[model samples]
Target: MDETRQWTAEAARAAAGKKGEETVVLDVGDLFGITDAFVITSASNVRLVRTIVEEVDRRVKAVGGPAPYRVEGTDDARWVLMDYGDFVVHVFLEEARRYYDLERLWADAPRLEWDEHDGRAVATRP
Candidate 1:
Protein backbone atom coordinates (compact mmCIF):
# COMPACT_ATOMS: atom_id res chain seq x y z
CA MET A 1 0.00 0.00 0.00
CA ASP A 2 0.99 3.62 -0.50
CA GLU A 3 2.24 5.73 2.41
CA THR A 4 -0.73 8.11 2.39
CA ARG A 5 -3.15 5.23 2.81
CA GLN A 6 -1.08 3.93 5.69
CA TRP A 7 -1.11 7.29 7.47
CA THR A 8 -4.84 7.69 6.92
CA ALA A 9 -5.52 4.28 8.38
CA GLU A 10 -3.38 5.10 11.37
CA ALA A 11 -5.28 8.33 11.84
CA ALA A 12 -8.58 6.46 11.69
CA ARG A 13 -7.40 4.03 14.32
CA ALA A 14 -6.39 6.86 16.59
CA ALA A 15 -9.76 8.51 16.18
CA ALA A 16 -11.62 5.28 16.91
CA GLY A 17 -9.57 4.66 19.99
CA LYS A 18 -10.30 8.15 21.25
CA LYS A 19 -14.05 7.99 20.52
CA GLY A 20 -14.45 4.23 21.08
CA GLU A 21 -16.33 3.16 17.98
CA GLU A 22 -16.27 0.67 15.15
CA THR A 23 -14.53 2.52 12.37
CA VAL A 24 -14.61 1.62 8.68
CA VAL A 25 -11.99 2.74 6.20
CA LEU A 26 -13.13 3.09 2.60
CA ASP A 27 -10.95 3.26 -0.48
CA VAL A 28 -12.24 6.07 -2.68
CA GLY A 29 -9.13 6.26 -4.82
CA ASP A 30 -11.02 4.81 -7.75
CA LEU A 31 -13.98 7.17 -7.54
CA PHE A 32 -12.72 10.57 -6.46
CA GLY A 33 -9.17 10.01 -7.70
CA ILE A 34 -7.99 13.04 -5.76
CA THR A 35 -8.61 11.61 -2.33
CA ASP A 36 -7.04 8.26 -1.59
CA ALA A 37 -9.44 7.18 1.13
CA PHE A 38 -12.30 8.01 3.48
CA VAL A 39 -12.46 7.05 7.14
CA ILE A 40 -16.11 6.60 8.18
CA THR A 41 -17.20 6.06 11.74
CA SER A 42 -20.01 6.88 14.16
CA ALA A 43 -19.91 8.76 17.42
CA SER A 44 -22.56 8.15 20.04
CA ASN A 45 -23.16 11.83 20.84
CA VAL A 46 -21.91 15.37 20.42
CA ARG A 47 -19.14 14.82 22.90
CA LEU A 48 -17.99 11.74 21.06
CA VAL A 49 -18.11 13.63 17.78
CA ARG A 50 -15.94 16.38 19.14
CA THR A 51 -13.55 13.85 20.58
CA ILE A 52 -13.17 12.15 17.22
CA VAL A 53 -12.63 15.43 15.39
CA GLU A 54 -9.98 16.51 17.84
CA GLU A 55 -8.28 13.14 17.89
CA VAL A 56 -8.14 12.89 14.13
CA ASP A 57 -6.82 16.39 13.83
CA ARG A 58 -4.12 15.89 16.42
CA ARG A 59 -2.91 12.48 15.32
CA VAL A 60 -2.92 13.30 11.64
CA LYS A 61 -0.89 16.39 12.31
CA ALA A 62 1.51 14.50 14.53
CA VAL A 63 1.94 11.79 11.88
CA GLY A 64 2.31 14.32 9.07
CA GLY A 65 -1.00 13.74 7.31
CA PRO A 66 -1.67 16.78 5.18
CA ALA A 67 -3.77 19.44 6.85
CA PRO A 68 -7.44 19.28 5.91
CA TYR A 69 -8.44 21.52 3.07
CA ARG A 70 -11.56 22.37 5.06
CA VAL A 71 -13.71 21.22 7.95
CA GLU A 72 -17.49 21.51 8.09
CA GLY A 73 -20.31 21.07 10.59
CA THR A 74 -17.95 21.08 13.55
CA ASP A 75 -19.76 23.62 15.75
CA ASP A 76 -23.09 21.77 15.43
CA ALA A 77 -21.36 18.66 16.78
CA ARG A 78 -23.75 16.36 14.93
CA TRP A 79 -21.39 15.72 12.07
CA VAL A 80 -17.77 16.74 11.70
CA LEU A 81 -15.82 16.50 8.49
CA MET A 82 -12.02 16.61 8.41
CA ASP A 83 -11.01 16.94 4.81
CA TYR A 84 -7.37 16.00 4.51
CA GLY A 85 -6.34 16.50 0.92
CA ASP A 86 -5.75 12.82 0.23
CA PHE A 87 -8.22 11.36 2.69
CA VAL A 88 -11.43 12.88 4.01
CA VAL A 89 -12.74 11.72 7.37
CA HIS A 90 -16.41 11.68 8.28
CA VAL A 91 -17.14 11.45 11.98
CA PHE A 92 -20.86 11.41 12.51
CA LEU A 93 -23.38 10.88 15.22
CA GLU A 94 -25.55 7.78 14.65
CA GLU A 95 -28.47 9.84 13.32
CA ALA A 96 -26.25 11.92 11.07
CA ARG A 97 -24.65 8.81 9.65
CA ARG A 98 -28.03 7.35 8.84
CA TYR A 99 -29.36 10.63 7.44
CA TYR A 100 -26.38 11.55 5.28
CA ASP A 101 -25.85 7.98 4.12
CA LEU A 102 -22.27 8.70 3.06
CA GLU A 103 -21.63 5.00 2.84
CA ARG A 104 -24.29 4.84 0.14
CA LEU A 105 -23.00 8.01 -1.56
CA TRP A 106 -19.62 6.36 -2.07
CA ALA A 107 -21.09 2.90 -2.27
CA ASP A 108 -19.28 2.12 -5.45
CA ALA A 109 -15.93 2.63 -3.80
CA PRO A 110 -14.52 -0.45 -2.13
CA ARG A 111 -14.43 -0.99 1.63
CA LEU A 112 -11.00 -1.09 3.27
CA GLU A 113 -11.10 -3.47 6.18
CA TRP A 114 -8.58 -3.50 9.05
CA ASP A 115 -7.61 -5.98 11.72
CA GLU A 116 -8.73 -4.56 15.04
CA HIS A 117 -6.25 -6.71 16.91
CA ASP A 118 -3.04 -6.15 14.96
CA GLY A 119 -3.52 -2.59 13.71
CA ARG A 120 -1.59 -3.38 10.51
CA ALA A 121 -4.15 -4.98 8.24
CA VAL A 122 -5.28 -3.01 5.19
CA ALA A 123 -7.66 -3.57 2.27
CA THR A 124 -7.99 -2.03 -1.17
CA ARG A 125 -9.27 -2.85 -4.68
CA PRO A 126 -6.89 -3.56 -7.49
Candidate 2:
Protein backbone atom coordinates (compact mmCIF):
# COMPACT_ATOMS: atom_id res chain seq x y z
CA MET A 1 0.00 0.00 0.00
CA ASP A 2 1.16 3.50 -0.77
CA GLU A 3 1.88 5.25 2.53
CA THR A 4 -0.14 8.32 1.60
CA ARG A 5 -3.10 6.27 0.46
CA GLN A 6 -2.98 4.38 3.72
CA TRP A 7 -3.27 7.64 5.62
CA THR A 8 -6.22 8.79 3.53
CA ALA A 9 -7.95 5.44 3.84
CA GLU A 10 -7.54 5.38 7.58
CA ALA A 11 -8.96 8.86 7.79
CA ALA A 12 -11.86 8.06 5.45
CA ARG A 13 -12.78 4.88 7.26
CA ALA A 14 -12.64 6.67 10.59
CA ALA A 15 -14.91 9.40 9.33
CA ALA A 16 -17.29 6.82 7.89
CA GLY A 17 -17.42 5.04 11.23
CA LYS A 18 -18.56 8.31 12.71
CA LYS A 19 -21.41 8.50 10.19
CA GLY A 20 -19.67 10.76 7.71
CA GLU A 21 -21.28 10.69 4.27
CA GLU A 22 -19.92 11.18 0.78
CA THR A 23 -16.40 10.16 1.72
CA VAL A 24 -13.87 10.48 -1.07
CA VAL A 25 -10.10 10.15 -1.41
CA LEU A 26 -8.52 12.10 -4.23
CA ASP A 27 -5.01 11.57 -5.55
CA VAL A 28 -3.85 15.12 -6.07
CA GLY A 29 -0.13 14.41 -6.10
CA ASP A 30 0.16 15.27 -9.78
CA LEU A 31 -2.27 18.15 -9.66
CA PHE A 32 -0.59 20.41 -7.13
CA GLY A 33 2.41 20.86 -4.84
CA ILE A 34 1.07 21.43 -1.38
CA THR A 35 -0.08 17.91 -0.71
CA ASP A 36 -0.06 14.45 -2.21
CA ALA A 37 -3.65 13.40 -1.42
CA PHE A 38 -6.92 14.56 0.03
CA VAL A 39 -9.52 12.82 2.14
CA ILE A 40 -12.92 14.51 1.94
CA THR A 41 -16.04 13.76 3.93
CA SER A 42 -19.35 15.42 4.68
CA ALA A 43 -21.76 15.41 7.58
CA SER A 44 -25.27 16.66 8.17
CA ASN A 45 -24.59 19.21 10.90
CA VAL A 46 -21.94 21.05 12.86
CA ARG A 47 -21.84 18.62 15.76
CA LEU A 48 -21.52 15.71 13.42
CA VAL A 49 -18.75 17.47 11.60
CA ARG A 50 -16.84 17.95 14.84
CA THR A 51 -17.40 14.37 15.79
CA ILE A 52 -16.19 13.13 12.46
CA VAL A 53 -13.08 15.23 12.65
CA GLU A 54 -12.24 14.02 16.13
CA GLU A 55 -12.88 10.44 15.15
CA VAL A 56 -10.63 10.74 12.11
CA ASP A 57 -7.86 12.20 14.20
CA ARG A 58 -8.15 9.47 16.77
CA ARG A 59 -8.18 6.69 14.21
CA VAL A 60 -5.20 8.06 12.37
CA LYS A 61 -3.29 8.35 15.58
CA ALA A 62 -4.30 4.83 16.50
CA VAL A 63 -2.59 3.64 13.35
CA GLY A 64 0.64 5.37 14.49
CA GLY A 65 0.31 8.15 11.95
CA PRO A 66 1.75 11.57 12.39
CA ALA A 67 -0.38 14.35 13.78
CA PRO A 68 -1.78 17.01 11.52
CA TYR A 69 0.45 20.00 11.09
CA ARG A 70 -2.54 22.26 11.36
CA VAL A 71 -6.28 21.91 12.01
CA GLU A 72 -8.86 24.59 11.36
CA GLY A 73 -12.60 25.30 11.35
CA THR A 74 -13.54 23.36 14.45
CA ASP A 75 -15.26 26.39 15.97
CA ASP A 76 -16.60 27.71 12.67
CA ALA A 77 -18.21 24.37 11.98
CA ARG A 78 -18.35 25.07 8.24
CA TRP A 79 -15.48 23.14 6.80
CA VAL A 80 -12.76 21.66 8.94
CA LEU A 81 -9.39 21.03 7.31
CA MET A 82 -6.60 18.97 8.80
CA ASP A 83 -3.22 19.22 7.15
CA TYR A 84 -1.01 16.22 7.66
CA GLY A 85 1.74 17.24 5.22
CA ASP A 86 1.37 14.29 2.86
CA PHE A 87 -2.41 14.14 2.98
CA VAL A 88 -4.94 16.81 3.80
CA VAL A 89 -8.32 16.00 5.30
CA HIS A 90 -11.48 18.00 4.80
CA VAL A 91 -14.64 17.47 6.81
CA PHE A 92 -17.44 19.65 5.61
CA LEU A 93 -21.08 20.34 6.10
CA GLU A 94 -23.33 19.47 3.16
CA GLU A 95 -23.89 23.05 2.04
CA ALA A 96 -20.26 24.01 2.39
CA ARG A 97 -19.19 20.92 0.47
CA ARG A 98 -21.49 21.79 -2.40
CA TYR A 99 -20.38 25.39 -2.35
CA TYR A 100 -16.71 24.53 -2.44
CA ASP A 101 -17.33 21.72 -4.92
CA LEU A 102 -13.82 20.25 -4.56
CA GLU A 103 -14.83 17.19 -6.55
CA ARG A 104 -15.72 19.41 -9.51
CA LEU A 105 -12.73 21.72 -9.10
CA TRP A 106 -10.33 18.79 -8.95
CA ALA A 107 -12.20 16.70 -11.45
CA ASP A 108 -9.06 16.18 -13.46
CA ALA A 109 -7.37 14.47 -10.57
CA PRO A 110 -7.93 10.75 -10.31
CA ARG A 111 -9.76 9.40 -7.29
CA LEU A 112 -8.27 6.81 -4.95
CA GLU A 113 -10.35 3.74 -4.26
CA TRP A 114 -11.35 2.55 -0.78
CA ASP A 115 -12.53 -0.98 -0.09
CA GLU A 116 -14.93 -0.87 2.81
CA HIS A 117 -14.98 -4.64 3.16
CA ASP A 118 -11.21 -4.77 3.65
CA GLY A 119 -10.62 -1.20 4.84
CA ARG A 120 -7.90 -0.44 2.32
CA ALA A 121 -7.29 2.60 0.13
CA VAL A 122 -5.51 2.42 -3.20
CA ALA A 123 -4.76 4.68 -6.13
CA THR A 124 -5.98 2.72 -9.14
CA ARG A 125 -5.56 5.21 -12.03
CA PRO A 126 -4.46 8.63 -13.06
Q: Could you say which candidate leads in TM-score?
A: 2
lDDT of every model, 2 decimals: 0.78, 0.89
lDDT of 2 by residue, 1-126 (tens): 376777788898988889999899998988988899889999999999999999989988888788999999999889999999999999999999999999999888888998765556767664
What TM-score does each of the candidates earn?
Answer: 0.86, 0.94
lDDT of 1 by residue, 62-82 (tens): 766677889999889787888
Clashing pairs in 1: none
lDDT, model 2, position 79: 99
Best by lDDT: 2
In candidate 2, how many Å is residue 107 off?
0.3
Residue 105 in model 2: lDDT = 91
